[model samples]
Target: MKTTIEKFAGDTEGVSYELTVFRFKGTSKTAPSAYIQAALHAGELPGVVAIHALMPKLRAAEAEGRILGDITIVPAANPVGRAQYVFGELEGRFHLGTRTNFNRDFPLLDRPDKAALPPPPRNATVDVHLKRLLVGLSVGHDIVLDLHCDDEGVPYLYVPAQLWPAMQDCAAAMGVEAVILWDGESGAAFEEAAIHPWLQLPAEKAPLEGRVVTTVEFRGLADVYDRYARTDAEGIYRLLATRGVIGDAKAARPRKFSGVAAPIDRVELISMPRAGAILFHVEPGRSVRKGARLATIVHTPGEPDGSIDILAPQAGYVLTRVSKRSGRAGDDIIKLIGEARSARPKAGALED
Candidate 1:
């Protein structure tokens, strides 16, 4: 077990942030390696707690000489977002200086023409530097898991389309309720950036035979309890064991999984029409039919018949909802997993 602090060039004068990485070295060089990170959006804390709970187990495995593969854990992946605050509230989803999402626009080397790859930009922002450092550490790993959480939702996973079938066991081990599969590049997200380069080559030329990468959404932001953390940690442990990264008796045993994997485009995103107080009629993991009233928005509560009902566009299960009851127009309010009904909006990224 080893710990190292990697420093990033600071955004402001006389200020710099450090990323702490925990490494558990394996004896064999041929063994698979894994990179697990949490809190890329620093406000998402379930992954942070889960990482904390996961550490003790990893330490125990190290002591027992059960570790087969190198494992790297970054409990807090974004120091810049962690320090961002407006008034008394913590703002960690996007950089305050640039308003860019913490998870999007990663530096990727996967180009159509190998020789056409652009050189690294000079005087890059702190976020770009952070992305470069994180990507540098994670590329070439056999498995990469970016732990995150939704505003208010059940446990779910966003897996690349190519990796979905291969990751069913991992999804089972993680006890996620749903798995969203995405193909093509929405944006150069961390997980996509880490795996896309290898995917660009022909099957015969690509070296991504055993690679697995996915974003594991732990749950809602408010679900930071120790019990949940422990459960999530154990799930991760089971996955590592199942992947042969660590030896465990239960590794060979069959595990039951309850989640269903669906295409990302099929997932319905219910956005707010007008800014108002929202009253939700459904919760996460509930099934609904087309035209079902999911929520009601009161644009003018004091006026008679001022409320507008939001209906489900398609039949599916409720996956998540916004944490805030009040939202502005066009805000993301709810998400549902269903058959493809309407085309996705013209957006650079998936999430708001």
Candidate 2:
């Protein structure tokens, strides 16, 4: 195991970000290589803590000569976002300067090789440069995991449609509650950028069966706990072993995915009709019948019919809800996986 510091100039003078990369060398060249990054949004710490717990296991494997393939880890992927504190809370999802999502708009190359990436523009923002650096570090790996978390939700994964069923083992190994398969475009998100190059080539050049790439939503934002971290770590370790990155005989086999798996279009992005405080009736991992009351918005506080009930669009599985109690008009409040495709489905990401 060796540590490498990746530094880049900030947008302004005397400001810069230092990204730490940890590498684990393998003895065998035939084994698959993996790259795991956490907290691309910076404040999402569940994956970071999981990686912390996983380091010891990797070290043990390294000491015992069990590491068969090269592995790279970046526990805290965004130092810039980590430093962005507005008033009191951490604003890690979008960059302050560019106001762009940290995980979106990544450079999509035509090939899996990093050399195909062109140099960043002279007038590009710091976030743009950061995206390029992340791509350069993560491209061409057999496995790439970008760790993120929803506002409030059960553990889930956003896997490209091309990798479904093949990636079912990954979902099972990670012990997530659901899997959302997406195709076409996701505003060129990191997951899309990671797999786009491979999709351009023939299967003979880049086999889909052996490749693993995903955006793992490890429960919710406030779910950072010691036990959960350890459990998530064990899950990731099991995946590495299952992929032959590490030779671990004791790791339990991944079970069949027993959770809900559906296309991204199956998600019902329920929005608030009016601005008000939200009162949720269902939590994550719950199933709802058609027209079931999911939440209520107190739009006008003192009137008898002040609150408006937000019902289920259809019979579906409740996947997530917003962390905040209040919302403006048309704010996306919850994600429910419906039995059928959404009537009004949009392309790209679920949200901006």
Model 2 ranges off by over 4 Å: 252-254
TM-scores, in order shown?
0.94, 0.98
User: Residues 221-334, candidate 2, lDDT per residue (tens digit)?
Assistant: 999999999999998998898888999866746568899999999999999999999999999999999999999999999999999999998999999999999999989999
Identify the runs in model 1 with alpha carbons over 4 angstroms from their true place: 111-119, 205-209, 343-348
Clashing pairs in 1: none
lDDT of 1: 0.85
lDDT of 1 at 113: 35
Give lDDT tens digits, candidate 1, residues 1-352: 9999999778789999999999999766777888999999999999999999999999999999989899998999999999988998999989888888899888777642334345558867898888877887777678899999998999999888887687888889888999988888768888788678778778777545466788988889999999999999998898888777887877535576667688877788898888899999999999999999999999988899888999999889899998899999999899898865445733334675
Clashes of each: 0, 0
